[model samples]
Target: MIDWRQLREIITTPDNVPIIGLILAIAFYVWYGLRQARANDRLIREVEADPGRHRKTQPYEEGWEREVQVWPYLLRIEFLAALIVTLLLLVWSLCINAPLEDPANPGQTMNPAKAPWYFVGLQELLVYFDPWFAGVALPVLILIGLMLFPYLDASPLGSGYYTLRQRRVALGAFGAGFAIWIGAILVGTFIRGPGWVWFWPGQTWDHTRAVYETTRDLPDLIGLHNGVAKALAGFVAIVLFYAGAGRLIHWLVTRSETDRRIYRATSALQYYTFQFFAITILAGVPAKIALRLLLRVKYVLVTPWFNI
Candidate 1:
């Protein structure tokens, strides 16, 4: 059972109050998305019914010309929204000071010291990854993946319009990734209390509670943690995961591919290469958590410099 009083107290904290507004904003965005999706679906059905009429009215290539000018239509809307946001921020600042702590003392470490709100997700990631990977490599890889997304996704179904059915795969993947980041931020902000221990809604906030348990590496889970064999096994696990999943997804999604072997090979290579990295980034945390809970596996990949 949850303690409503405790939950309310936690949410009323300065660090957590903004999340209420964020939630409401997300709800509005979802409602808007649904309305837009229904409209796009109806338009698509109408176009499919009378292809010649729709093409003559709105050509596929010159679809950009069908849009209105941004000067007033979109720009004014955005400008007014920004002005309202700025005023809200002004009021908020005047009423409440930003959450800040006193000057750091090297001698006394702050218990459960946290990063900035945006970075709290990365701080939470430290539980599953080394700092080098969580704080540095993961963020770098995410940026690189986002930059490479255009090249990876060659589909033109949702080129100039918003349609859920046309771009479900891409949007679903993005939404899932965004949700993971947001969940991490929430956990770091409210669920994590003193000493970086996870505190549930009903739990008492015990500052003196110790949470210092030695985590075990995956190799150690199977009675092997040292030597080249361990690294080989780790690499083999990752390769098998990608190879099996990639082949399966390719078969499912590309059943209508051309019979040209060379073209198919090239396309499959490109698609699976991108999928390998993206899936790794998306599934890394959940995989670690599952392993930790089920098999007590700590690090899935261990090297001299880093363990992930």
Candidate 2:
């Protein structure tokens, strides 16, 4: 069980105020889900009572009624938006001073030395993965995922409108990822102290505090620790997991002939590759958490070149 006081202390920090953005994002999704549920219920009831009421709705007329000219009207709105953003930034800059540490010294290293707030999430991931994997490979995969998302997400629902019911999977995945990244940044900024020890808000930063977390490698967990054997076992395990999951998804999800045709038309190998990368990136967090909590397994595929 987590110590609520410790967790709360980690969260409740002046420097960690931006973490509220993540909380707000989650709350917004909760509210959106509720609203979408109510909307769905109403639509179902309406359809049952009068099936033809909404069915006969004509195509949207994209004339003056549905369109706005890009003149004084749109221009004025855009100007006000920019003005408000600029004013907010000006006020924020005035109120909060930027954090500037002491001048760089080659010999004097700051314990828990963090990247900028934006990159803090990736930095924190170094705890779970090797520097090359966390700092380089994952970041490259994220960029690839972003570039490949539109191709993967073929759904046409919620294109212009903001409805959770229409785009639940996409939005939920993105929101969860965003929350994790923000949460990592918050932890790095507020909870981590000297030597990267976990420190709460009320607790004093004890420089001598030792955080000795023993992490078991994947092969060690399954009682195989020979280097070559472990590497081969790890590779086989990952391949099996990926292939099993892909087969399960392919079998379980009932797709139409047209969908199958589309899949055939596209590069199926590329599609599966992208899907695997996406799954690993998104599911890795929860997988890591579960392993740490249940088995005290720190790294899954630990090799010389990479660790996850």
Candidate 3:
């Protein structure tokens, strides 16, 4: 059932090797961070129960000052880290060949022509979204959303520390967006084959393979054939989706007393901004992905200027 040869070729490609390394690094760091967070959370609970006890989340000796000089204490460690990274880069450069191809030819194009690995996620989004939406609007929204995070989040807990229980709503929203981006990259790298068709990891990359699947827009499914009717239908559907998803996310975020307090402290502007980005990016993305993949529905919202 598995084609080892095909899988080997994909994994060994020079352009793909970095993605493999990225996956490993992400896994290790997430595990380590969560482990540390658990330990710190336990320490926090103990200190809350017994205020007389003196404890530090980090290791501290009795004689050391609360802070140290940055020149030697911090810069030295940074310099050493830089040197180690340089050495590793040198070794890696020597071991692997650069992924370069011959000069481009106007007559022939490479099958499954892909963007650089970093932009592969956006490229994969083309399957489910229009070019303008995938390439421009989504990226702009993501940048703005990131910039708005600090202002939007009113929580003071878990500052400068890795603790999930204290910052569940903030962490959950960010983690969901990050996971979606990473998933898109992985799918683009390993699962997309010639013609941008979906292929299982072990399946052969057939150059001549032709898929003839028909996709439909949501409006078409409900017998809305006229252009204006389709547009109106799509607009109504999107409005309803936002209303439902916003309510659900609000309930989830305000389940705990801490969360409810934070929510109450936030200004209307901040709350609305957070809800807009959360529903659009965090919830809208997976919803669209599901529609496209499972229901074969495209362009849930179609207007004269844009189709989403």
Candidate 4:
């Protein structure tokens, strides 16, 4: 059998590097693309001037509307941003020292070390919900909701325009998610460390352990089957409030107590404010359960891995 690691080392050596091949491949593609563009331009002019050569020759010269696609410009920005982020990550990985924790023993954990950064938000969520809800259902629902976003709000109002042309609903969703949710994740991951602690970290408090203990007690919630029950109740309450509030506002607007247009504008804000809580409740479920695993909560629902 081939020694794969040895083979990889040989192929990756400085003398045998693939960079030379990449340069040549790029040069060849540039020439080939220019040639194709020139040929296409030549064909278009030939077809436009004569009636016999191409199939669709017209009696009168057809007027053409100039169209410019914004995608190419947007694509360049996206590509540049990706490259910059990748380079920053590489520098960070090299400069920052992260020593692996002491050898794993089944019953012990290292004092300050924890799971990777991306998972901290989800880990933090467990403080609010059940493990099944926090770990599985909530995360999955959030992802599914994000994926269905375009389909759910398929308005063509701004298709030929930019953000300024879109409805307030899209704008409100963007601000809530980008400004609030994403900023919290960034602060949580970078600013907070050790024990799901919040607000000013120093040698003064055991925020890490504090966060952990609080999350652990989350699952033993009084008179609770699962966090799903609490979330469902919250959902029902919010729906009733939103319906009542929206109708009252609309009726007031009809009487000219408020501007009808302004009331309509707030309609998106009202709809989205409720959606914000709905998603949070759904996400909090599994997080709570995962926290409770420490207390030995016997969640009767079986895992698929167990069945297998």
Candidate 5:
């Protein structure tokens, strides 16, 4: 449906949208770094100036320790979320009845056959580079970067206190990344406009399925494809995993040891294991999704070692 005349005529709309977004991003990061510098700059002292007397650290107070034990409050909120999710899942399972396709036909594949929701981002990435790059190498690199954040930017500002602005910025960005990942699924399902086709499993599989079946033309912008979306997703993940979320995780897990190297190594090892499990599960997405739907099985069964 794309012709030179029609394409040329469609260029009246503004094309600087992504550029504006990039400019805003650069400006915000610069501002954030400067603000951090200012906060730390105030704490700096001149070596030649009068030496200040440092106060001795006090022991933990009984009253303050009692106030910190809000486990009951945390547990109650967590249980409420779990109960709501379980009820919604029960309703969804009953209402949705998926029909089994005729025994995996090799010649005739289903249109828009996708992976499970958890692995959709990785599956989308697989479209960009080779399976090894998308499914393994990139995820490994991401994991390594996430684990190295503490050592890279060791600003012990909020180590013992919760009033640091850097912590707030990091937490906000981490929450935003989670929101973005969830938002991607919504956009993929609801906002993917017509006639756009990009996937080609083999060289022979012509990318005409969506083009032939759907209405409206695909986007011509730089980041309109699934591949670009995956890259954006990864970029956001890096922000959360390393810059934002990693800072919070470092504070949390290594808190008991005065935040030492041993604790950092322990947290990194835990992250490493989780990354491995996630990557493995993501690689088998196509089959995993098919089997789960067909057998009505959950990923985690009720075993003594684990509970779903």
Candidate 6:
């Protein structure tokens, strides 16, 4: 039977409220953005088919100036938007209580002690990865990978417009990462219960629940017993993954003629940099998650210095 009370408690938690809001807001924006992108793509196709006819992406009366004054036109919209947001915040503050708890006591630690919602994704990673990797290395890699995107993307299309046909690869990579990050946050907030145990939305939070599942390393699964041998096997596995994933990503990103042209234009340095980040961050996150959750594999790469 479903534990509705437990689910309600979790959903109503002050700390979780913003996450719920974020999910809703992101869903709306994604739908709206994709809808507009599709429309723009269609318009582009029509324009290309018939260049003799002049067409604007947005329909405007003839003789209307392409640009409007920023002082009243743009600032008026911005001011209204700011007022709406401010009013919403004011209402929210009055309705919902702040997520403040009693002062911390060493003797009374909260079960499933979680970070703030924003950092909860990283906290969830700790369950599947080593502390150094999940907490420090992964976060740094994500930031660097994000910063490298503009430098790596050679596409001139979709600069001033929203269109999937023009920026599929770029959008797809970003979307996948974003989806994974949001999924982690959702799981950490709602699925994790007391003692950090997995609990479905309607499942009761069993404080006394004790799970004793044994997790195995990748090398150990294939009968590699010696320390040096296990490390070698793991290193080989990581290298193979990178090699295969790079090829797969390259094929996917360079399928279209335009994409292939962009690939040809990209420098060797840029291509390699893109592959490194895409394989490690894009392909690696889901791969590790599958290994950990499905295969119960821990530490695919283990060495004296660190484990991943």
lDDT of 5 at 234: 39
lDDT of 4 by residue, 71-181 (tens): 897788999999998997787568644445567797875543434445555665554445666578767866766675655453454342222322444545444443334
Model 1 lDDT tens row, 15-125: 777776676887799788867776787777787898764533223564356678889899999999999999999998898677767887898888778887778889998
Model 3 scores worst on lDDT over the 10 consecutive residues at: 52-61
Output the worst ten-in-a-row residue range by lDDT, candidate 6: 52-61
lDDT at residue 68 of model 6 (Cα atoms): 84
List candidate 1 segments past 4 Å from native. 1-6, 52-79, 212-214, 247-269
Candidate 6, pairs of clashing residues: none
Per-residue alpha-carbon lDDT of candidate 5 for residues 116-144, written as tens digits (9 for 90 to 100): 44444555544333466557765675566
Question: lDDT: which candidate is best?
Answer: 3
Question: What lDDT does candidate 6 reach at residue 100?
Answer: 76
TM-scores for every candidate against the unseen true structure: 0.81, 0.75, 0.96, 0.44, 0.36, 0.97
Give the candidate order by descending TM-score: 6, 3, 1, 2, 4, 5
Model 3 agreement with the true structure over 131-194: per-residue lDDT tens digits: 8978999999999999989999998888898887788889898999999999999999999999
lDDT of 6 by residue, 60-162 (tens): 6788888889999999999999999999999999999897788989999889899999999999989888898889999999999899889988888888778
Task: Report the poorest 10 consecutive residues by lDDT, candidate 4.
Answer: 299-308
Badly placed stretches (over 4 Å) of model 2 are 1-64, 244-271
Question: Can you tell me which runs of candidate 4 are displaced by over 4 Å?
Answer: 1-90, 97-99, 178-180, 183-187, 190-195, 202-308
The lDDT-based order of candidates, best leading, equals: 3, 6, 1, 2, 4, 5
Q: Give the TM-score of candidate 1.
A: 0.81
lDDT of 2: 0.67
Candidate 5: the clashing residue pairs are none
| Better-scoring candidate (lDDT), 1 or 5 | 1
Q: All candidates' lDDT scores?
A: 0.72, 0.67, 0.91, 0.46, 0.42, 0.90
lDDT of 3: 0.91
- Per-residue lDDT, model 3, residue 82, is 100
